[model samples]
Target: MDIEDTPVLDNHMHLDPIEGQNIDAVEDFESVGGTHLLVLNKPSWHLFDPASDEATFEEVFELTIEAAADASEVLPGRAWPVLGVHPGLISQLVDEGYTAAQARDIMQAGLDVAAEYVADGPALAIKSGRPHYDVSEDVWEASNAVMRHAFDLASEVGCAVQLHTEGSEDLTEITEWAQDEGLPPEQVVKHYSGGRLAGPIKSVIAEKDELEIAAELDEPFLMETDFIDDPDRPGAVLGPKTVPRRVRWMLEEGWEDAVRRAHVETPARVYGIDTEATLGR
Candidate 1:
């Protein structure tokens, strides 16, 4: 499998249900003649956020898993799943001022709504039999541990890890830690390099520092446009058809081919996905 043989490959994307968008990207990929598509997992419901009670982390994880399973079945080996906690969720869950009650409510609501579509679990052994609080310094460490476990689970299930390495020292540190723990650098794919705007990662692209890091570590890197329609973050949305526009910018800097090729070739090798298979000569 190779790039020339395939119609197109979308390296970074969220396939699980979001807000209320019914057109999961996997289906959309098939319609567009995309030979191979990789979908990243959002953290489970219970762990969604301490502020909202939308659903449980376990529940959302299940939904994502089911969606991956369904996409695999529907596309018959054309779609693959990249499981991990997205960074946006991590940021929300860890922000200092975010109230625990608010987090719980928001997460609960999402979890409840997704209940019918997914199951929850891999529930942690809460020491005091209570939800983890946001403000506690220990909470950040604890959440990292939980996400690390999720990463292990994803690997066990033969899925790639699609991690959002946005504006956080924690994420960068975790990536380094994962490498130390024997996870190959190629196994992790960094997404949404542009949307991030804080922490150490905030100015990665602006500084053009990440490329050196990526080359030095030999990791497969990806840049993305998070075309999310969030009323809470009204300025975040870049409309639904923003991919091409983003691609154009990447091309202007002579990065479009380099990034896309790295994304397709490297991940294909890591996940054992045959690129030629999708090309359908």
Candidate 2:
């Protein structure tokens, strides 16, 4: 298939209209042949106070939904919201004097609000995971508890989850957590993966080597830039145009089938959206 005919999607990304290059970044992606985005909510600290109540989460989710809506004006129906509590909030909560258990409760409450958004049709998926950095054991356990609650919420909403976590060779434990919660393992995506996960769907970053590794894997996987959309950190994880550019490279290198899976089929399956329709096929 021609590159123009393929639907290139960023499975996980963030857009901030207030402090970041919001819709302008979407235009950049479109200029480079990017077709879709899973616009995610930024962490609480990026938007407002970290230790605020559940109403604060409502505001964050609303901002994400609005961001996605604004992007849709550029990419039409291709941009979607993925809302949730950022796992790093656990550390911030603890530092602010809330106990680990209290932090877990707070995060779960945030997820509860996010789930309502998904169930009500504003968001396509939820974003949740344990802290990517090291922390005390109690905090770690609390983070896991929060993640499990995310899984349950996703199951209830019938949506996928994009996880942000530390690098690991094996993701079997997290996959089992999804299974125990009655959510399919494939619905739990390991965002920013290096393309070496044993279980859970891999949302591999669009670097060349990582994309190559993920292309060789038999299991279905997705691709992303994880673009933070921060002007100061310009292209921190990867640029908005990275996914489509790498997809063109994949096409030139004879990985058309992999491109189809990563850009079209996998996203259609994971997010339960019709990519062909989104691309106006």
Candidate 3:
């Protein structure tokens, strides 16, 4: 059986241009060991502060959903989208003479668009989170407020969330917020988690310590390459092939069950993409 037949699901990846290469990200992923992927558009973490054109937000929204739509032709049920305005973008909007509330409105607009795509089957999750550790406390608060609003929208739309965050200091608070908003903890996914408290589910870097924590988790979680796919930074975090390669070693170490939970079952439950069914499509 092909790796696609084994049904590897990449929980998080960016579909940025691979410099000087004619590459179809969807096909390349499946050619290795990726069957289902949650593709976040390249600028999902940037821009959004044009302060003049509504098309700025529209472009970010369309690019994400359209990528999934385009990928569906190659591997139906395999390309799931994770769309939403990132916290950094909201900060930029605020820096551009917009109040925090106004910034949130822009992000919420993007979420509404993402929710529509999720309803249409191209999007499976919303990606949003607070700022980094170095920003001012006020900026952090503003970012957190925007994130809360995004969570509210995600709850209303009944889609999963992919959070771009540093350490898990606020995991408990975030989880409480999700539950109170009627979004279950299971749907709140924190990206780049390691030494980070597991949030309902999380996508962690594919390092030994990270994988070890995931292997020993009392509950299931996701592992990822967080592959940027930039030519200048080829495999900055890890290459697209890394997840499959690591998983092979994990299996050798008797982590077959954990790997299966992360790669197949959890994704089906969280993202609603049927990995097994995507094969041979």
TM-score of 3: 0.86
Instruction: Indicate the residue-level lDDT of 91 in model 1.
Output: 44
Candidate 2 per-residue lDDT, tens place, 72-123, comes to: 8888337899999889999999899999999999999999999999999999
Deviation from native of the Cα of residue 89 in model 3, angstroms: 0.9
Clashing pairs in 2: none
Error of 1 at 150 (Å): 4.4
Ranking by lDDT: 2, 3, 1
Once superposed on the true structure, which residue ranges of model 3 sit more than 4 Å away at CA? 1-5, 17-27, 44-54, 72-77
For each candidate in turn, the TM-score is 0.53, 0.97, 0.86
lDDT tens digits by residue: candidate 3, 168-279: 6348788787787788888888888873474457787788777877787745678777776666676656766677766766777777778778877887777666676666
TM accuracy, model 1: 0.53
Q: Candidate 3: give its CA RMSD in angstroms.
A: 3.0
Worst 10 residues of 2 by lDDT: 272-281
Q: Identify the superior model by TM-score, candidate 2 or candidate 3.
A: 2
- Tens-place lDDT digits, model 1, residues 9-56: 445444435553424544544553444445445454323443334335
Which scores higher on lDDT, 2 or 3?
2
The lDDT values for all models are 0.41, 0.88, 0.68
